[model samples]
Every structure is written in structure tokens, then in C-alpha cells.
Target: MKDTSTGASSGEAVREGPDTFKRTALLALGALGIVYGDIGTSPLYALRECFTGPHGIAPTPQNVLGVLSLIFWTLLIIVSVKYLIFVMRADNRGEGGILALMALAMQRQRGQSTPVARPVLITLGIFGAALLYGDGLITPAITVLSAVEGLSVATPVFEPFIVPITLAILTVLFVVQRHGTARIGSLFGPVMCVWFFTLAALGVKELVHNPAVLSALSPVHGVMLLVHNGWHGFLVLGGVFLVVTGCEALYADMGHFGWKPIRWAWFSVVLPSLMLNYLGQGALLLRDASAARNPFYLLAPSWMLYPLVALSAVAGVIASQALISGAFSLTRQAMQLGYSPRMEVVHTSAEEMGQIYLPGINWALMVGVFTLVVTFRSSSALASAYGIAVSTTMVITSIMAYVVARERWGVSRALAIPVAGLFLTVELSLFSANAMKLADGGWFPLLLAVVIFTLMTTWKRGRAILAAKLRASSIPLKELLGSFGDHPPLRVSGTAIFMTGNAEGTPPALLHNLKHNKVLHEQVVLLTILSEDVPHVPGAERVVVEPLEQGFVRVVATYGFMENPSIPDVLKRCREKGLQFQLMGTSFFLGRETLIPTKRPGMAVWREALFSWMSRNARSATAYFRIPPNRVVELGSQVEL
Candidate 1:
């Protein structure tokens, strides 16, 4: 039986079971491509960095087994247990991400025992989301660089071309984003399927010669490595942490392919492939420690090297695509949630709501990726800058998950604390390990996060302050209508829709029209658009229309944070509720604010200037709302803050 509430099926073979199974199998394949790309590509550089990186230890048998043990258990505990089993349960409706989790946790739950304030959780969530942008920038740079670096393994003659080849690949990757991934998205599954199979095949080939390396599966060897190597072994964690760098994508992309598909992909394909591959690399090290320089490439025969390089480059592009798409999604959520200024959002796929492209974000990421490649020049140098942002984000996710469990899920503090504590303990340790690289290159993402966080917070605060100022200066709708009834103005022939931020007040554009033209439309609509803290608002509950005096009507249209509002769509919904609108006869009045930063009490002078700059550059409401540009009447106004 299918559970309508959660949209999950119980284990009974019904008439539709076969179809459901096929659909799920397809989705699981797709998940292998998009969801696992980052972590899946990590095998290229993660193990190599552990033993050969700056903090790499001597490749003793004990150290090899120990590091392999750490990789094995870390995947089980962090990716399988924590993310797949526990954290995915905290999804908002069907959507999952740090922002979605923040919204879910913000919902008021009775008898809640969590001491953290809502604002604190929100700030943390925003910062976490900001950190992902840094990840987005670095993922493309590092993954592509690592993939192209494989050419060097085949022959040192290809060394000179690695950086340029990586740059060209990444440039093509970003340039194609505008065309959409709908067509190529299908190929991702099959390609990644082959990639994973290749990984397993390579590992098994090496494992047959050195099956003894399987002894590392025990936690004892991992413990012994640390016990034996002391501080150096602890430092190796910075490299080990790279294995799970893209684990957050599992939860973040849960909305695209449900947790079930992600989990299936992980267990049935991704997890086993990764384990075998890591062990194979370890076994290769045991046989010949000299292979540590490029263990992943060296695992294959000389004949397979070029083919492997080609596959790795393709896989790297797929991995970069996931992070780029995620950054776009995160930006949209931030915009809808009032934490960001508006950006022009393009719908890439008509059939899929989630497939969107943001040009501003795309170009910004492209530039950031280019800068990193040009500056760092090598994947190993770039690797030092990675892990830190993602690890910090993981720590924040754990904290938010704790609050979500205590409040949203109504789990007792007793149960919630220890589970959250376990993840936190592991994550914090990884974070500290990555922190040691701050002077080396880890500071890049942290600095980037701070800049993004500042912009988000400033935009949010600035909008709130702007609304307050407008509200204080505005006239109430009821009072305005009463005066209009007392002395009616010259009535025009068509409908005039005045968009307002405050639902209860007369819009500034409406007042401006009255003052200048001294006329009113035959019908006037005071329309207010609001964003709810959910992924989707039902169509039946999308619009609310109220008839007011003097041919005036009040309409409130609500959309979810994951949605882009459309004025024409809202009008059509209003028509369903007995309110009529004509395409050519309707006019939209929007207030165009000219912000003047002053020595105000609301914010620092620098922040005010930044907010003003953002506001000035933000996409216009006419474009953002998909309104008819020809029908828009923009009224200019100045506001000092």
C-alpha cells in the first residue's frame, strides 16, 4: 500500500508495483550521477593526498591498514548511518537542505526543550548555506584539476597541458549551463554507472593479489595508526576527511530523488565501489609504496591509463555540475526566504521545476573557478583549500539537526543530544584537522563565506528596515477607501493593480497616481505577494481575494520559497475565484525606490551603502514576477536609511 501522507510505499506488490519499481530504479541511477558525483570523484585525489600530502606519513604496513580502516569506518558512520539513516529524516516536506531544515526547525512546536533561539538557528543556517557557495567554487576547480592531472600519470609529456586542459574543460562546463542539462542529464546515469563499475573492477583486480589488505576493515588498525603515529596520524585526518567531502549532496539533493533512491544508490552501488577502490589503492601501496604519488591512476595497467583519464575528466564535469546546480538552488531559496536580493532566474526545463539556471550565479562561479585554477595551478595545492568549508558546513548541519530533533520531531533531549553529539564529535574533529591548513590555503573558503554571509544578512536586515519605514509613512487601506467614498475621483476604463509590500496599507504607487493624475481605474487591486517557508504552496491555497469599497479589491498571493511567483498566474487564479482580469486592459503599478544611505541608527554606514548597492542592482519586480513589461507603470520614490 502507498502512504499518501509521506508519498512512500509499503512492501506489498500491488498492480502499480512494477511501474513504481522501474521509476525508482531509474531515479536511483540518476542519483548515482548527480548525488554521488562529488564523493565518487574523491577517490582520484583523497587517498593520494593522505599518504603523499604535506602531512602524509611514511607508508608502513600499520599506517596503510590504519588509514584504510579510518576510510572504511568513516564512510559507514558518517555517510551511511548519519546522513542516509538519520539526517535525511529531517527533510522539509519533501525538500532537504540546510535552509529547508532551518525552516522546518523554525516551526513552533509545543513543549519544545531546545534552548537555542530561532534567530540563532537562522543565522547559523544562512552561514552554512553561504559556506556551500565556497564549496561550489572549489569543487569545480579541484575536481577538474585532479581529473586532468591524470594525464601526467600516463606520461610526464602531458604535464604542461594539464592546467590548460582543466581550464578549457571547466570553461566549456560553465558555458553550456545556459543550454540546460535536460538532454545530457540522462547520459549522466549511464556514464557514472560505467565509472563506478570501472572503479570496482580496478579495485578487485588489485585486491586478488593482496586480499590481505582486507584486514584494514577492522577498527583496530585505524586506532593503531593513530596510536602508533600520534600527532602525525591525527594530521592525516585532514586528507581522510576528503573521502566524505561531498556527503552533504546526499541530503541537499534529497528533494530531487527521494531519500530511498539516494540510499539505494549508496548501498547497491556507491558505497561498495568506494570501499573496494580505497582498499585496492591500499593494496597497491602495500605491494609498492612508490605508487603513493598517484595511487588511483597507478592502480590500473599502463594500457588503461589514457581511458581512465578520459573517464575521470567526464566524471569531474558531472561532479562540478552537481555543485553548480546546488548553488543555483540555494540562491533561489535565499531570495524567496528574504535573505537575498532578487536575481534573474531562468527556467531551463519546462517539465522539471527544479532545473533552473541563474546567469549571475553561473558567471560568478565561473570567474571564481578560473581564479583558483590560475592561482593554485595544481589539484594538490587546491585540495588544501577544500574540506574546510564543507567540514564547517557539516558541523553546522549537525547543530541544526539537533534543534530539529528536539523541537520539530518532538524527540526527547535524552535521545537527541547523544546522536547529535556523536556526529558533532566526528565533524568537529574533521573541522579541526582541516583548520590546520588555514595558513596553507584553507582561509579562502572561510573568507568567501564571510563575504556572502554579510551580503545575505545585510539584504535581509535592509529589507526589514525599509518595510518598517514604508509602513510608518503609509496610509491604511480602510482609511483611504473611506476618503475615496467621501469624495470620488475621475474613474478610468480599466483595472489598475498596485503591488504593495504591506497588505493593510495603500501602496505608494497608488498614492503617487492619485497625487499626480487625480484619477482612479474602474477597478483597482491592492495586490500583495508573500513567500511561505515551505517548498510548495497548494494551488487551491495560492490566492486570497477580498472585495473592498469603491471598485477596489484586495488580493494576497502566496508562494513557497522554492517557487518563482508569476503575476499572470496569480491573475488567472483570482479569476477562478470570481475576480476577472483582462490581458490588455490591466495595468501594474510598481514603486521604484531610490535608496540614499545616511548616518542612520538602523545600520553602519558601510552596510547601508552595500545594501543600497544590492538593492539598486537587484532584478526588477516586473522581470522577477514574470509580469508584462509593456503593462507596467513604475513610480519613482526616494528613501534614506
Candidate 2:
């Protein structure tokens, strides 16, 4: 078995050097803008949705307290305990996400004598990751729609212009993605600080008048709500789950800022503000049940309403930005890990490798967001579509986390099972509640997830079949090199590098080049790039050189799934290993395979056709690998899959 451990093992300490108070505070503030955006902004609609949404219940004192109790405990147990404490600990070399956790769990399983069901875990992880794309779509739509909805509460005249204004705002948000957030990113922290403070202030204003609402903090109210309301109260969880919708963002973005900053931002600022705001909303409902229609916006005084709507809109944009950026990052990871087709990826910031913009992904999300906003029209309607994707993803994360705890942390099953069981029970209930909304717009995200999942699995399986076919037909590198002594081909002066998937086999490009051109280069380098399970591969261990007969060498470059592979960078590193290259003097030969759909034992004909279409549309290897287009030669071949 391969050594699956990235340099940092589970037992190793996370280095937080240069951890001055200023730096830590800055990081925590940054965490506030990015990590807490989704959850923090939940105050806009979560409480109001419970009483006024599709499955809303009457905001009687008992029901209000019950819903508030459920919201409070849900945040405490799920966000603070489940994600910040447990799931964040299962990081893959300081990276977190469904894919990262999946990789981590799979990596540990590779090292075990008695491995668990690998396929099941991978499928679940992929589906979970797919669900995030669905979440990404709905988050921006719902958050922005809810924020803009506040304008109507301020005055009914703004109701007619809400959708158009939202469309305009979303257009600007997606448009600015290409320029990157480096400049505006600094402002995110301070702006969010204002947002959170306003949230606390608004909540306190109401709480002073009705301190009786604080009793909902007791878990008994939440339990009693379910008991008294019975099935209807259980259905209230669908709306309640919205409070924790952004919880995954906390874990997914763990690598951007360390877990400590995320935790600090949560406990020190975000949690208190959110809880107070929620309790205040409950208090307002106690005083006036009619306020349940728009409790969040109603909390503001008459003069503050417009300003609060503006602030809510800005906060919504920030939250939307975070989710959109996450989608870009996730797409890149999927491409690198072989689960997605390659698309053009542009790095937006020189200092930040994580800042990337994918035109295809950006535009696709823009389209999805537009469809969602137009179809649902109102935030209350979109609320019916929201929680299903996130709840299902949470359940998947819990399962993957359980596997990581048992296999990687070496935690005994005795302790892990009950802990995992507790999370799963809560998550499943949330999922079950959301399931009731399947007919009322929840199908949208689930449908999108299914489509994406199909494409991903098709691409992965198709690539595997294609590689197997190529390896079967290709000659071994040793055999090809050994035959050179007996019958030497005409030697050219320049160095030729052929890229191949199989390190041990002669590249199809090389074979095609020799057969057609009838000549071999003075120096032949067969290069293969491998993506490891880790988040990053250290520079020193990136390139491996193996010399073969007659000036033939086999070079393998390894990259982590999180890193992009650059041919120029690999060659620069090669210089340290006694292999030098002149950019102009080197020719990169890549195979341009035309995939043919067939019924011969692999995938179904329709899937083969889909794979072929995807392969043809994928970004060229030359562009993706950052090889100079001027120094490239493509050799064409046909492969049946």
C-alpha cells in the first residue's frame, strides 16, 4: 500500500507560530466575514419562516418558545459541538470540505489491514459534495431575496421592484468575481462586524421590552413544542434547520483560516449575536403574533428599517460571495482529483492560490441563481426549497466523520459510535422534516444534485476505462528503450517530453510521433503527473526522475488535489534533480484522444456518449498544465470506451 499520510499526521500539532494577538484577532475577524456569513445572516429569515413559511405553525407562546428552543439547541449542538469541535478535527492536512474529509477517510482506509466499505463512503462523499453545489445555488437566491424582502416591510412600494433589484445585485456580484476579492476582502471583516453588532443591538431593543422570551433557552421548551404540536411541530424543524444551513461553510473553509479563528469568531461574536437576535424575534412574536409575518425586519424601529434593509442586502451579498467562491474552489478540487472535467481556471490573486475564478462555474451558477429567483419569486417560497440539500449534506458529513474518527484518530468504536449516533439522529430528523417539502420546491436542489452526481461519476468511470484501454495497447517503456540498440531511429537535436497517464508504459504520443515522423529526439522525457490524496505535496518530494536506456528518462510529478500542476514549475524543480530544460528547446507532445462510444463491456452507450462529449469539451491539457502553447505538439488517436 502507498504511504497515504501527508506530512501532518493525526497526532501532529497544528503550528500557529507568529500567533500575536493582533494577527489572531485579524484572522478571527476575517473568519467572521467568510466563515460566519451564512449562519450569521440566518436571522433574516429563519425565525420568520418557522411561523410564516409553507409549513409554518401558529406563533402561540408555546410554539414560539418551542421553535426558539429548537433553534438555540440546534446551533449549540450542531454548529458549536459537531462542526467546530469534532468535524473540524478530521482535517486533511489542515483542509476541510466533503471532498477533503472523503480523501482523509479514504487515505486512512488505504493503510488498514481490514478496510471498511470504501465504495459506499466515496459515493456518499461525492453525493454530499454534489449537494453543496445545490446549496450554493439556493443560498445566494434565498439570502438575497430575504434581504431585499425587508424593503417591502419598510414600505410596500418596494415590493414590485424587489426581483429586478435582486437580479441587478446578483449580476454585479457574479460580474466582480473575475477581478478577485483581494481589495474588497479587507472590508468584509469590518462590514460584518457592523452587521453582527446591529444584529445584537436590534435583538436587545426587543428583549428589554419582553424579557419573558429568554425562557425558551431551556431545552424543555423545544421538546415540549414537538410533543404538543406533534407532527406539525416536527415539520417545523424544516424551517428551524435553516439556522444551521451555513454550518458546512465553517468546516469546508477550515483551511482558509485555521479552526481556532473559526471557533473564536463563532463563540466570541457570531453565536451571541445570533442567539440574541433569535430570542428577540421570539419576544416580538409574543407581543404581536402578526409580527411573525416579518419578525426579523419588524425588530427594527420605523426610522431604522430602510438602513437595516440596506445593511441586510450587503450582508446577503457577502454571504452569497462566500458560497460562490466555495463553488469555484470545489470545482477546481474536483477537476484535480479526476472527478470533474477540466475547465478554464484563472487565479485571481498573486498572493492567494485559493482565489480562483472559473468562467464556466460562475456562469452556470449565475444561471441557476436566476432560475431560482424567478421561479420562487419570494424568499418564503424559496425557503421551502432550501434545507433539504444542506440537511442531507450534514448527514453525509456525520457519516464520513465517524469513519475518520474510528480509522484515523484510532478512537475505539465504543466512544465513536455513540457520538456519531447522536449527530446522525439529529441530522436525520432534520432531513426527514425537509423531506416533507419534496413536492413544494425541495425537488429543485435534489434534482440538480442528481444531475451533477451523474456527470461526475460518468467522467470518473469513463476516464478509468479509457486509461485501461490505452495501457493494454501501449508498449512498456523498458521494452521500447531496449529495442533502440538493435534498430536506432533518426535522432533529432531537441529534447522531447511526452505526457502520459501510465508511468511504466510508453506514451501513445511518443509512439505516434516515432511511427509518423520516423525520428527520436536526442533527449526523451516521458512525464506523468499524479494527484495525491493530500491537500499539498511539498516541493522537495514533487518530482521523481528515473533514467532509462539511450537517453530516455521517465519523470513523474506528484501534486496534491488542492494544487494545480504546472509543467513549467515541474521543469524548474527538475533542475535541482540534475534534469535541466531550455523552454524553447523543449517540445511537449500530448495525445489528443477522440473517444468513441461502444457497447463492448464498459459503460452504457449513452454514458459513453456523455463521456465523449465531456472529454471533447474539457479544457486542453496544454492550457491546464500551464505549458507554453508555442512549444506544444499534439498527436491524435482514437480510443473506444
Candidate 3:
């Protein structure tokens, strides 16, 4: 019982048939368009940057061989071994991402019911997610710029127009986001298929001229380059790091397409095409050292240069689209987990649950990207800011993965230590090499991560303080129910429901309604919506209803962090539990908090002010939960912390 509209299971199990197989194949094709777009386009600029970049080397026979060997090994160890094989296995109920994996690991610890809590592990994962926002900003700027820069290689006149052309293409790309990708999504797989084939075809054409370049496949050459070149060779790693920038998508997208299809897509199509293209670039450089300035474009025949540039631009947009979608998904998960403020989330596709558009996030990213394009002015300059953010994220994933293996999987520390140690060693080396370029442009992502991390933590901590203050001032449920029975208020004829964060205590709205109106509804429902750490809560376990004294009913609605919360839908579930709903007869009461900052013990005055501002801007619960707007009544209260 798969619910195609929501992408969630409807029953105990998923149906398996020929239809399922076909569906999996289609998803795999789509994954190629979105998941592999960023990494696949690296051939356009990775090799060229290695030779002509700031730390560029001589395009000598030895240098070319060494660089090729490094590229091959990086793809094998980082993408193939670390992520596809090991990390993807640590999914949160078939969902994969650093945050999803973190939830899985935290659940494993909490299952023990121990007194000690692991806050540091949770903090590490949050910081990793924050870094991705920075990466999202840079991916579009660099990938699109690199693709358009290929035009400059054709003629000197096109060089002057490259920036303007890039800006125009990016403007259209971001503008169309509100319309959703479903209409054009079908074309992505086919277009990317052609793009990769062209990449392989160009590589094969050059490799046929000088097949000896294949010798670079051996590890010895890569090692020799580093040993002989010393400091200069070490600096080349900054450029080499570009080849694997999009590796994170492989894991992040596992929820959309299963691990099996992604693995199949990788070994069968993406890996081979990428290797051949890089090898082809190496062969081209060996034949003519001067081609190092733009070896990727040089591999193409004179007649095909313009068409190739056109195709490359499309691929760049596809890459940026995937990053933008991923950001929306991550933000939703964070809000559900109580780490962020509630915001408006619009579902863009009726058939696809994952297709969504966020106005706030979309505008913010557009501003950051356009600023980067104007500031950097060239692809190579923007490259300096790229690797550090992704590299740091990779290292953080490795450490967190080790914790999952040991604590969750019950693997022995002896085995997990060395296995994870190898990954950390390599990733830390890449991070340190990229760190050398901090003053150049690398500071941008780090600074962005710090600002976002502060905001996330502040929202989370502020909510905790607010809840504590409310609980301290509130009366227990039993005490309120007894008082209602003793001094029975005037009875109204309709039903009234009050939503509260704390289910065990009397809601502030309920108390206010009793005090001002001096009357109680014939049927009263105290409802609380609870978000679980898992992905989806089953229908049977979604609602818990209990009978209380004085005609009062307590209802708790549960949802997974990945699922959207809807009051109407939850009420339908309540109907199955023998509770009836009438649109006109039922009235929903909500409590709205106005945060007032003070020099309190909980947080600094400046942070409290920031939290108050965020609270004011967050979406209303009635709108976010999709309750009928006309049927809702809000009561306001001020709280100081």
C-alpha cells in the first residue's frame, strides 16, 4: 500500500511487482539528472584549473600523470568507497543525509534509557547541515560560471560577454523555481544522458590518439608527483578537491531513489563516463602542453564547441536545482525536530511529496548567488571559496558515521576505529590543503555557517526556556478538571479544541476561554501534535484519545519529522477513533506567544532580542498546520525570559 501522492506507506508493507521494478528504473534515471549533475560537470573545469590555476604546475609528462592518478584515486576512495559502500548503509528508516543519520544514531543511544545525554553529537550534525547552506550558495555560482566560460575558449569576443550571459541564465533559472520542476523534470534524465555520452565520446576521441596516458591509473605516479613536487604538489590538491564536490548528493538523495538504483547508476554510468573524460583530458594535455589552459574545451572538435557550451549550461542549472531542493528538504526536517522556527512550506507537485518551494530560502539563496557572481567575476576566483565548506562537511560526516557504527550497529570499536580512521585521515588532509586558501575566498562559507548555526541553536534554546517558564506558572490537568467540576461554568452547545505544546498541563488558551467567556463547550478536546525523530508515523499509531472528567477528551497526534503536519488530516484519523467532526460546530482555539527579552539567566540580551524577532516572523500555527482559517480563534500572551 504505497500512497503515491504523499510517498509514504499506507499499511504494514510495500507491494512488490513488475510495476515496482519499472518505477525503480524510472527513479534511477531521474537520479542521474539531479544527483550526479554537479559531479558530472566537473570535467569542464577541474583539469584546466589544475594546470593554469594559482598553484598550477608545468603540464610536463610527469605532472600530467601524477594529477590523473590523484583524480582517479579520489573518485574511488572518497565517492565509491566511503559514501556509496559505508555511509549509505546508515539510513534513518530508508532515508539518508547527515541529519537523518544523526537521528538514527541519537535514537540508538536514547533506547538505552541512560541518564547521560549526547548533546555534542547532535551539535556536530547541526553544524554539518549549516555548512551545506554555504555550499548551496557556492555550487550555482561556480558550476554555472564554469560552464559558460567554455564560450571564451572559442573566440576572444565571447570572453567579454561571458559574465553577462551567465548572469542572465542564472536569473531565469531561479525565477522559474516557483513553477516547480515536475513539468521539465522528465527531460533532465534524457538531457544528462546525452551530456555524459558526449563527455565520454570526446574523451575516447583524444585517448585514441595517445593511449599511453592510461599508465597514470597506477598509484605510483600519483605518489611520485607529491613526493617530487613537495610544496607545489601539495597546493595542487586545492584544485584536485573540485572533482568530488558533489559527492554529498549521493547520500542526500538516497531517500528519493533507493540505494540500489543509485549504486547501479554510479557503477554503470557516472563513474565510467567521468573516468574516461578525465583520461581524455590528460591525453590532450600530453599531446599539446599549451592546451593546459582549457584542456576540457580543447578536447572538443571545432564544429561542436558552441553546442557543447549550450548543453553544459543546461547541466549546470540541473545541478543548482538539486542543491536548492535539498536545502528545502533539510530545513523542513530541522523545523520538525524543533531546531528551527516554523516557516511556510508549499508543496509544488501533487504527485511528488519531495517537490517543494520555500519563498524565504529561495530569495536568500538568489541574493547570495548573484552577489558571488558579481564579486568573484570569474569561475577560477569563485573556486577558491568552494572546496573548504564541502571538505569540512565530509570530515564531520566521517566522525559521525563512526559513532553510528560503534553505538548503533553494535560493531566493535577495534574494527570501526581503523576503518573510520582511514576516512578521517584522507578528508582532514583535503581540508587542511583547502585551508591554505582561507584568506583568498574560503572565509565566506565558514562565516556563513557560523551565522546560520547561531540562529538554529538560538531558536532551539529559546523554545526550551519558554516551555519551562510556562510549565512553572501552569496548574496541573487534574487540578483544573476538579475545579471545573466544583464550580461548573455555563455550558455552550458546540465543541471547542485548544492546541498546546505541553499535553500534560492545562493550555493557556483553555484557561483564558474559561475565565473570559465563563462558559465551557459541551465537547472539549485538548489536542497536542507531537513530532517523532523517525521519518513517518503509522496511521494506526497516529492518534491517542483518552476520556477525562467533565466531558473533556485528550487527543495526541503524532507525526514523523519528514512528514507535514495537517490538522484536517489528523481530525480524519480521529473520526476513525469514534470522534465526529462538523466544520461549523467545531471551533479551534490557539495560543500565540509574544516574546519579551530581559537580562535573564537563560540567554544574553542580544540573542534574546534575535529570538524574539524570529518568533514574530515565524508562520502562524493555523496556517502551517492547515487548519481552516475562519474556524480558528487566537489568544495572545506575553512571556519574558
Candidate 4:
């Protein structure tokens, strides 16, 4: 029997201690590699796009300062103030993300003295999560394309091969994902450490020559340009929005590195480096307007251009890797919470539970990424589609954050409303600027988000209806036990374990087994596994066992959304509670349902069909839960939707 009091498992790493300067500084270093990669790489294209792309303005002195000021303020306000200060405080037990925050809001709202409508809050959260998918797809495509576009600036000869080289690099990056990042992840911090220093150095070199460009730091220049340039300056916001593109990753990665590390890294290193780089680009444009065509690359001397471009490509790959890993994590969380279908989740590292590979998501993202590269071809073209998904997601997050502030933080409605209002006002304006390019490449992400939202909502609703039907037809556990007293079958020798989705009623698999076998095992165990909303649940609270009459036992095993449940492992833990288990003597029974869709009032026929297909294709419970194949038996049943 295993001891239930041992809360920490050998397979995982747990950090425990009060906050200290050393720990915070180390975590902050790790945060730079994983959390800041995407936004860090934005300098390769963000500034150039503002002065050269379709929505660009001339690189005059006033215009250059105006754009630089907007980029600086956007980063300071959106990434620093809104997310770092406000959203990070709303972590779900040390985890922060759109889904984690959503779960936190929903959990607290239910227990509030006066609650808001829960459905509206949930819908807002779901939409925000859906938009992240679009962001994930676009981040890789644009980041890589922008990095390689630097080749054209170095010389026109490398221009024709730019697309092919990018394709090859992305192909290799995605292909190596199954091997896990445990080894390479260490190198990320040091490499990014060097990269940030280079950015600051390059900017400082230019700032010394044109110290007057420092005036762009003031808000008055940004406001003057917008008012004087009219609609042209407003449209340039679509490009300025790119500077803070990867801010979401910082929040999403809070679970891996605590908020303090991420906050420290941003303020200490990332913010300073980015400000210097943007100001340098502006200074370059003031002296030579032609440099606006590729101001970031132009900041480097001819001798350093090649090395800098090489460094940027590596940074781009690291950024893409972080986003890809995030996609896998989000998908797993969605599945556990019943917002997505079950898929094969492969744990790539024995030491790290968070390192996982999903074949389905891997290939799907590749297809979308390849299509975007082929369709958009250039970084400037791809930039047209970049910000809207993130902008919309930010707006939704602020709305959800308002609820968290009022209910969870005990903030007054008067203060919370205005804070949320200010956030929305900024995000919506950015979204509106990006919306102007809808006909241009912007439609791709919006369309993709809509499709995904439909599929997720349909699957969730379908499962609810199916569970209700199953519960309605299930026999009470007391009735089943009473029937055995009246007419008991022949007693078998070994133990029988029946897996069920519901705990309060008799399992369909057990009923089918009894009907066909005409015998009962000496020991029977009915088990139900549940996935909770939190990221991790301690092992001490993992299992609940109840002994019933006639040698029957009911077991409920609970796992958190971030966990991967294993049946045999969980059953091994149950032995400490006086439940004996021998793998050779135990027989496991599982039910497999075949759905037949009809024109049901619960769902449209088309949606029912889609859900049925997804259900049929979902990974089997036996394989997913790591049950021994030799000891398993399957029973089939039909379900109508």
C-alpha cells in the first residue's frame, strides 16, 4: 500500500520557499527566453512596417518621433501596466493564462454575495481562448517571415531564396518538437541574454549621434502627430500594435516562471532593450529617410549585418517554439475541462510533466503556417493580419478581469469599471485600426477563430446532452445491490473493475458483463475519473473510496486540468485505503459508445454529426489511462444525439 500523505511525487520538480532576490533574479532570466521571445523579435519588422507598408507614412522627423512614441507607450501601458500589474495578480493557484483566469473568475463568481450572469462571463472567456488559436498560428508565420526578410536588406541576391530558406527552417523547427526542449531550453536564456544586450548596444551607438531623438519619449509628440496627420496617423496604429505582439506569452508562461521573475525580466531587460532599439530606428530615419525601408537592419554596420541577421533567425525560431508548446498546453487544458475532444498526448520528457507532444495539433498548425507563408510571401504582407486576433483577445481578457477584480479582489465597482474601461478603450482602438485591413490578409485569423469557436461550443453542448441521457437511463446503485440479494448469480473467484463516467449509478459495462457472463466476481470496484478546473491537485486529495454492501466498492479519482491521469497508477494509490490490488487477478471492463445522430432538438443535425465523428475518433480510454491491455475487456452500446 502506498502512503497518501506523501504529497510530492518523484516524477515532478517542485520549488518551495518564500520569495527571495536570488530566486526572483534566476526565474526572471528563464522568463526572458520563454516569455519574451516573440515580442523581443518584433524589432526586426515593427518599425519598418510603420513607415513602408501599405498603411505607412513618410519617415519625416515628426512622423518618426510620433511612431516611436506610440510603440513605447503601447508597451509600457499594455504589457507593463495592464498585464504585469493587474492580470498577474489573478493567477489560478500560481497559474496564469486566459483559461486559468477564466476558471478563477467562474469559480469565484458562483460564491459571490451578488453574482453576475455566469453564462456571459464564460462565453467571453471562450471567445478569448478561441482568439489565441489565431494568434498562435500568425505568430510563427510572421516572426519567421520577418526574420528572413532581413536577408533582402543585406543584399538583393538573397531575396529570391528568402521564402525557401524560411520554409526549410520552419520545417526543421516543427519536426524537432517531439524530441522536447529540455536540453535546448537552457541555452535559450543565455542566447536571449546576449540578444538583448546587442539591441541596447546598437541603439546606444546611434543615440549618441542624434541625441535629439530622445524627445520622442514624451506623449505630446505622439498626440501632435495623430492630430496633424489625421487618418494616416491613426491607421499607423495597426503597425505600432506589433511592438507588444507577444505580451500574452508572458502571462501564459506565469505558471512555469512565477510572476515576479517575468515582471523583473520585463522591466529590467526587455523594456529597456526594446525602447533603445525603437529610438535607434527613429534616429536612423531622421538622418537618412531611405533607411526607413529597413531601419532595424540598417542600425547595424555592414560588417555586423550578417551576424545580426543570423541571430535574429535563431530568436525567431525560439519564439515560434514557445508559441507551439503553448498551443499543446492549451489544447490539453481544453480537453480536460470538456471544451475539446480527447487526443493522444505524448509526454516527451520523463522528468518534466509539462513537456508534451500532440500529433494532431502539430500537423494542423504546420498546414496553416505553410499556407500563410505561401499566400502572404513577404513579412510586410503578413503583418496586415497580425494584431486583430491579439487585440480582440485582449479586450475579452479585460472584460473577464473586471469580474475578477470586483468579485475576487474585493475592489469597488466604481474603481474596477473605469480600470476595465480604460483597457478596453485602448484595445478596441487597436482592434479598429487592424479591422481596416480586413479585406487585405486580416480575414484569415478572424475566419479561423469563428470556425474553431463553433466546433468547441458544439462539442461541449453535445457532451452535456449525452451525459443527461445516460444518467436518465442509469439504474440506482441501491436497486442493483438489492436485486443481487433476491437472486444472486454464481460467484467468481477474482476481482472485477468497471470504469464509468458517473459515480452514483450502475455502469453500463458492468450490466453488460453480468448479463452475458451469468456470474459475479468475488470483489467488484466501480471507478469514475474526474478532471477538475485547477492546474494541479495534490496527491493527498486524489482519491475517494467508499465500501458498499456485497463486496462492492465505489472509487472516484480526481486529476487537475494540467495533469495526465493514469488508471493503474491511481488504483495503486487506492490500495493504501485497504483496497487490495493484484494486476494478474484483476479484470477491467470498459464501455465504448457508438453514436447515431438524429434531427434532435438538442442540437442541429449537422453539429450532431460533427460531434459524433469527433467522439468516434477520440483516443480510447484504455490507452489514454494507461491500463494493461491483457487485463481489459470492452463492451459496446449505442447512443443517440
Query: Which candidate's TM-score is highest?
Result: 2
Q: Write model 4 residue lDDT over 101-178, tens digit each, in one string.
A: 888888888866354478787777777888888878888888888888888888999999988998898999889888
Candidate with more favorable, higher lDDT: 1 or 2: 2
Model 1 regions lying over 4 Å from their true place: 1-17, 109-116
Error of 4 at 612 (Å): 0.5
lDDT of 1 by residue, 420-504 (tens): 8999888888898899989889999999999999999999999998998888878988898888767988998999999998999
After superposition on all CA atoms, what RMSD does each candidate show versus the true structure?
Answer: 3.2, 3.3, 2.6, 3.7
Question: How does residue 323 of candidate 3 score in lDDT?
Answer: 83
Better candidate number, 2 or 3, judged by lDDT: 2
Residue pair clashes in candidate 4: none
Cα lDDT tens digits, model 2, 1-641, are 00111111222233445645555577778878887888888999999889988888999999999999999999999999999999999889878899999999999887572544888888998899899999999999999999999989988899899999999999999999889887787778789999999999999999999999999999999999999989999999999999999998888777777777778889999999999999999999999999998999999999998899899999999899899988988888888889999899898777777777899999999999999999999999999999999999999999999989988899999999999999999999999999999999999999999999999999999999999999998998778878887999999898999999998898999999989999999999999999998889998899999887788888999999888899888898888799866778999999999999999998999999999999999999989999999999999999988
Candidates 1 and 3 compared: the better one by lDDT is 1
TM-score of each: 0.97, 0.97, 0.96, 0.96
Q: What is the lDDT of residue 139 in candidate 3?
A: 88
Off by over 4 Å in 4: 1-19, 111-116
Q: Can you write out model 3's per-residue Cα lDDT over 370-452, one digit (the tens) per residue?
A: 99999998888888888999999999889888888988888998899999988988888789889987888999999999999
> Of the pair 1 and 2, which is ahead by TM-score?
2
